[model samples]
Target chain A: MIERRIQSGVGPKTGHKNEKGVGCLNIIVCIKQVPSTSNVEVDPVTGVLRRDGIKSKMNPYDLFALEQAFLLREQYGGTVAALSMGPNQAMDVLYEALYMGADSAVLASDRRFAGADVLATSYTLAQCVRKMGKYDLIVCGKQTTDGDTGQVGPEMAEWLEIPHACNAISIESFSEGAFTVKVNMDHSIYTLKIEAPCLITVDKDVNTPRLPSYLRRKRAGNAQISVWSMDDLADQAESHYGLSGSPTQVERIFPPEAHDDRECFKGSGEELADRLYSLLRQKKRI
Target chain B: MAHIEVNQKKVTPEIAERLSSVCPFGALVVGEKGLSIESGCRLCGLCLKADKDGVLTLVKDEPTVEVVKSSSRGIAVLAECMGNQVHPITLELLGKALEMAAPTGQPVFVVVIGWKVSSAVESLRCYGADKIYVYDDRSLEHFEPLRYASCVEDFVRKVRPSVVMAGATSMGRSVAPRIAARFRTGITADCTGLALREDGDLVQTRPAFGGNIMAQIVTPRTRPQLCTVRYRVFDAAQKREGPTSQVEVMEEPDGLEKAGACILEVLAKPKEPDISEAEVIVAVGRGVKDEAGLHLVRKLADILGAQLACTRPMVENGWFDPRRQIGLSGRTVKPKLIITIGVSGAVQFAAGMDKSEFIISINNDPEASIFNISHLGLVGDLYEVLPAFIEKVGREEPVR
Candidate 1:
């Protein structure tokens, strides 16, 4: 049996300095471009995804993150700079962010950054964030629809040596260089006050993201979007940006097997209900 | 490091076209000098496998850093405690770890970290762990990511385990990547399959691209390969009678009390058991339409003593709690009986509950994909079928 010891006065303290010391908040919202449709199919013979006419769109979850940033900036008098790391085509999402009220945009486009796993992807994003300059908050979507790995935001926080919180359902308040956020952890919800220079990944439906304004798009004609590659970043090592920097390797990729043998019954609602109820009784599943 | 090397002698125009078309990411380019691999090459080796005449081969180079393969040993599982009882997923992972460790003769260890978790630690003894590490402290009651991750880091440094696994619960997903980043190793999330290679490498298989494809990942050059497995993906370890296991109480690490974020309040949701643990579930999707439609489904669930679950759209529409959502992005459940209403079975949604022992899906659309994986498919309106089903169940003998 182990003895239990109690500690006294172990709660959170106030009056921490706003690390950046900026009068207003400077936010960076990380966004991504994912395949517009989830029904991507693979060719049987070649075993490759048929990507001929698949359109791209901003990850739906990132829209909520962008809305959160825009809302924060509206209340707190700050600038929201949208950042994305992908091919040059990714700049379209950055421009969409601008039309959605972002002050500026930055795209980290480089051939060397391809084939990055979570670790390498986060490292490259962190390097890009550092190059973009001072920011009090970095917001990201809960996860990308394609990758569906919620690890990138936290891993980026780790690389920057800052604290991070995921599944943020709401941002309650901000004062004294700390933001009180309500995080949804499956079984419970926690309200935490984190100091500045931290990262957060917001959950879906946190807010109804505002649509891109046609007027704003016309006014922002020929808006310059900064593009940074390996040479522009602080870390120029080829091993740290792409596949070589990634620790995990994809051993195989194949289409998931589908269940083909199934029974189907089509009839009126009353007939189907009776059939299902009787089937349930026969199977002992009631 | 490794790369794709294209042989010039064997490359004809026809072969070059085939090779270029074989790469999924469009990494192979039929350039003026023949086929060349570009930066988009993911080292997936598909082109090499497609090359019948040896036009392409993967070349490996000596690693820059020496891999100390002998320093690490054993598999460690991070056991989670919910209100003094060990979470079932922890036992599932331990069972998996034991199976993987049997071939290598590696020891199995379980790490429990929380406040006053002695009961949880003791409960794990019967699960067949060789040793248990406990970090029970008052300040560690509510999960602070920094503190929890620090404790895990200390354990990893001390034990030097070759592999670490945790459940893909909220807490596990939050802390696992941070620990992996601390060790600068690879961490796979939401892995549905895990196996150990003869060389002791852990291979993780997970669905990607919205469950359209499955990817097998491995950490070739990292130690303590980390992964988070979803609940019900593996069987729980059976408790042994009169089990003998060494219990080691870990000392609190330095600065354990100082966390970057301070918890202001912790609100435990009402005592609804997790959907994954339910024996019977009635799941709804966008086809349920309005609040009135949802009410009828709920009534059916109540009649059958089944829990309520939903697809991703229902959660996004704010019709149900995110916890109840089932898909690749949400929880994975393998209940004994699952009944889906007005659900178009997308691959992502099917990935979560297709393993249920009995599945019955009702949709108005005759061609909905939900019918493919379902054992009993009913093509009818949910609003009409739900009430009729409720009436039939109510008129019959009470559900057992």
Candidate 2:
């Protein structure tokens, strides 16, 4: 309980003089560097993702989340810090975030944190959040292309003890202490007004993400990304750090089977329908 | 045989009251007789976190316990139901679970948790469930993610099954992850294929990177392997006379009323037949430029007596109901015949309709990806091709 209340209004701001100086919000955008190609290899012996020597990119979904953060920062006058957890190479995504106008960036990496699942990953990220000072909001992609769980944001919110909404389609409005967000909840869309210090997992296509500005890239070329290890986190529990902290174990990984059984028929509209009807009738599926 | 016990000598009323607050399920009760452990206890160990003086202990039935591999005795299927009828995907999952259990000496169990689901019990037995665990309670009258997950987690821990399968529907998508998070287990979502490895492990396959590739995943070390198979990926389990089934009703977990995110109100969509059930479906995409284009698409659907569906663009354009949209964010359909008009098949849209028995796609651009999965591809302007098809069908003028 070492004063986790986030310090307000303290970061490299876009020195605009016309901004309101009362209380600026701090937003943390959670991002990850995933295999640029979906053809990722799994370690046969260890049942883990093999990350060595593969081209990586910022998760496609995270671009939406980052873009949303930048839009909010431009509108409400806040600092956006991009955070990620992976190998030391994960800093590449953080640097991309910086070029895309993140005020600052940080990467939490450790050998002990390897092979972590959704729960362990969320817990580790929560620990990093605690150590990285306070923020008014945390945003993440709806799900990772690699893990695709869509549980980390809410789970991390549970660990941090905050409210969160998933599948967010839009940020309708924001005021002093709360935000009105529209979320697609499967069957229907819901408009929820969540208080500050909340988390949201943004859906895809919320907005067009701006390209990394060459001017910002040149100016921020010397910007440093702070790296945090397990020791830096408030919770230094060994069991809660890496593979041991993970409840689910990867027993095995393999490629999926595919069926190439197909018959192509060329015909006119009526002929195709008649042929389809006869085929279905033969199979007794009509 | 792991069970929670309260030490009578060390327990006090104050401690008992605190213990009652600790278990979210309200398993530990403080009564005139000091304290009692109820059947509703889920063994979540939240009480252990609260009891500082060690008044309660979880006693294992045996010592020197070797590492516990995944359960090898039973396969479990989570029954997803709505409007008192079990979703067909539940039966499909049960069918696959039964197949997975066939080679191994394991029984299939179905857990149906809802009110007034007695009729579903017979259907579960017909679908090959040896035992149907029913938790029919007032608290479960409506679906709440936390409450439903707590109930399932309690049952899962009690009878550690080898594999747990659920339909990759809205409810499944929401609750499965919560259960996995609670048990600290791995779960694969939207799996298109599932198979058993040589050593009784499950190999779950799903599309990744926007359907660029299909990846196979496994839980490997987790007990009660969990996965959510997309709808229509497998055929529905055929009904058969199985062994005389037993319906065991478990006590409802208490404190479910306090679960977060109460459904204030569920605004129903406009009444329309679920497109997945349609035998023939004709869908339109962005290629259908205007209302005139939509009219022809409707005309063709009417000629075939088929249901009308669309890709995300149609719904986004306000030309079709969201319910009629087919894609990853929309409903999944596996119709006998599905024809796409002017629809360039994005992976998201293809995921919902790829399992159709036959696919015929019409796109003016020959390079459109929709041709990749189609059984019949027509490269022509829809405006020109639609009228010819309508005339050849010899259908009466469609009444608007």
Candidate 3:
């Protein structure tokens, strides 16, 4: 067992994250495929995307980040490489990006890449980004819908030795290589400028994503998609990907077990309203 | 399926417990039970992979934080759009902001179209907006962010508001960070509630680190506090008689710069479950067991005519659609009737599905927090409880 602790000052410094985006900006965005829902109804028998006619889609927030990238392209005219770590099907988002106007896309798909945790994910993505060449800017959603782990983007930036903002709301500019932007942290607004190749994870409100033009959508669907497996990304210790590489493992799954005396108050408006108010007050959810 | 973070070092159980306290899941026990696997884990598996010595295992764990927040100034809601075809959240924000504002001196002001815009600014008066700042313009049609930010900046400068409220809509969200940055203010995303502090500070509360933890943050320094409320978290402001009009309008952004940020195309969402508006939801996680069990719940849903939703597992296993899953990775639901079967109320999973009108939880764990929020807590296996429910309902009951 390794005994360690985060230094008191090890947390992100209180300053602008985009302070250095003043130079020629090179950016790479790492994305992932996540279960859009935590309530993913699984088959006790076979774990699979139930096509029993049920449906699913990409995480909505990721699309907004992609949209922000497209807008950035319109502004700075830089290369936007969409990097995602997932199964072969994860290409759906990559292709979606291409259709929306990404310069290129890379798929980190491999058996070994399966079940990688945030640390492993960031490690693998940093390596993949290194392989994808250089960039001044990197973007992603604050957190994937399923994984809900907002650590990857910041973790990736830390591993890559670049500054990062975990909750970026607006990107003011990306000039010279220094990127200037704003973030919502704790309760303060931070206007920061950082050197390029920095990482940013934005919320869905960052931008209204443009619908994929039918033409580009078709082109991306037909483009020669590049798939990079664990072997393809890096020849690291086999303990680096999936369950073997991951430190945390999901031991078991169970539904929430609770027995609140959730007795409903059925009555007239005043009574119900009183009941509702008391309930909210009791739960402290008001 | 766990994604554990390796801080390049291991943390002591004490610190782990502290981090866990601030974490969405419950505190780490350090060794033994907390090590191998947790007791209240939602099966997110993110923290699990953060280590390698098998220090942390993904089990059903408790959410470190609470969903609601507290502050001195009460809830600071930034109401963006609230006229014509107003989103229910707009009024809900108004009602909540009014409630939160009443206890404190924080006035709930509604931000409308910037100067010279055509949105119905007058209609907002009925919803509890103490003052209105309408920044209007043609570019504001689709909520041009640049213009929105510029307008908010102007309003914040003039008002010096204790808390600047905004909806978590695409427009409000984009505008929030930029505005907050302009003032160097701290902004919380998709917050479910807001409150004030004894020191007259705003506590911006929302689900943090995913749905596992609900956190309350305060801007101890920045002025004109900011908070972005998640949609549908509160009830709409009931309309009042006479007039809900006669409000104020704000100055528009600089013309040329505002017109420059163009929106090439904006498409409305076209889908089902519209999880955003569902009044009745039956969210199922691992408690429903496997895909076959999901079918049973679906049958029950069909019998009750309720939308069937799942947790992350069903999607990971391809047993359900990602859209239908509830939690941090999924949609937030505040249904009228939310029946849980076998689902452990992990904080992340609980964050998105906790706001139901009537919550009925069916899990074997007698101490699960789901009972804390359930309208009716059933301490038994869902398999046993569900059949009885189906019989009672007879068939799926539509909203006839």
In candidate 3, stretches whose alpha carbon ends up further than 4 angstroms from where it belongs are: A1-25, A30-137, A142-260, A263-286, B1-77, B114-119, B209-213, B244-246, B255-260, B391-400
The weakest ten consecutive residues by lDDT in model 1 chain B span B60-69
Provide the lDDT at B26 for model 1: 62
Error of 2 at B156 (Å): 2.0
lDDT of 1 by residue, A87-144 (tens): 7778899999999989899998776776688888888898888888878789999999
How do all the candidates rank in terms of lDDT, highest first?
A: 1, 2, 3
Q: Measured with DockQ on alpha carbons, how good is candidate 2?
A: 0.07
State the lDDT of candidate 1 residue by residue for B1-400, as single tens digits: 4567788999999999987876655678898998887765666676777788888887754555556856888899998888698889999999999999888899999999999998787778988889999998877898877778878888998999999998888788888988877777889988888998877789998877553667889998988899998888888888989566689999988777666688889998777657988999999988988879988988888877899999988887777888798888877899989999989887678778877888999999986878878888999988888788888877776644
Cα shift from native, residue A69, model 1 (Å): 1.7
Ranking by TM-score: 1, 2, 3
DockQ of each: 0.42, 0.07, 0.07
Model 3 agreement with the true structure over B1-400: per-residue lDDT tens digits: 2333324245566545533532223323355434322322333443443343444534322322222223223333455553345556678778877777676666667777533434455566666666666666665654544455556666666666666677665446555655543443345556665666656666655554332334455555446566666666777777776454446655454552322123434334344456556666667777776656776677656654578887777676777776687866567788877767777776676767777777866677776656667776566656655554544344423322
Over all chains combined, what TM-score does candidate 1 have?
0.87
Q: What is the lDDT of residue A123 in candidate 3?
A: 68
